[model samples]
Target: MTAPAARSLVLDAQALSLLLRNDRQMITRIEAARRTGVPVLVSALTIVEAVYGKTDTARLHWVLSRLQVQEVTPADSITAVRLLHDAGDLHGHKYAIDALVAAMALRSPPPVLVLTSDRDDWRKLCGDRMQVKDV
Candidate 1:
């Protein structure tokens, strides 16, 4: 069988951190994905999770310039709640951002790959709708 193709790439907080740090491996992966026309995405909420006061503003802006920052719509927020509820009532602050990320990924093109450290959490949130690859 042919290798599975990735249509979109979603980066969670951990992966986004690595990318912001200019990690060689992460950069290579992102470049390769871009070369193939895969949209590298970061949820607008992920900015809240990944960026902080100590972060380098110049680097942050530079990196963000290269990726797609997906805005969270009102409908997406509703979907995020449903995802949390569906995942066995996994509500509360801890799961809220992840649910949003999963919601965004679910609405993206198929074969969506999420680079995250929380593999199990993403799997639970995304179900069979998207792929979770550890950062």
Candidate 2:
């Protein structure tokens, strides 16, 4: 018998906020991933966007405890800059944090899934490289 394929989940800012707000759907997906031993990831930029200007330390701690936070490496930063430039050319604007998240998702192992509220932006950024679930 073959083992199930390894899977990982990347959460965007809106998805993280929904999870913090105790949204049933996001909670269900996150808990299901946890049960299946799938690593739940949050980009550093997403963390910034999710928790910025928040005064609730306890809630922030709780949210932070739920997922693995991934930092942008030097390589990721370079790629993100390029992605931002490309997005600016393509969409007439830049989504810096989204580009960073997409870059991180691109480098993750196969079968990666992204939970995002901005489906169109992520789809454009990721370019069919990963599965995107709308939150």
Q: Could you give candidate 2's per-residue lDDT for residues 59-91 as a string of tens digits?
A: 878878988989888888778777766665443
What ranges in model 2 sit over 4 Å off? 1-6, 52-55, 85-94
How many clashes does the backbone of model 2 have?
Answer: 0
Query: How much lDDT does each candidate structure score?
Result: 0.90, 0.81
Q: How far does residue 54 in candidate 2 sit from its true spot (Å)?
A: 5.2
TM-score of 2: 0.85
Clashing pairs in 1: none
Reference-based lDDT, residue 118, model 1: 91
Best by TM-score: 1
Report the CA-based lDDT of candidate 2 relative to the real structure.
0.81
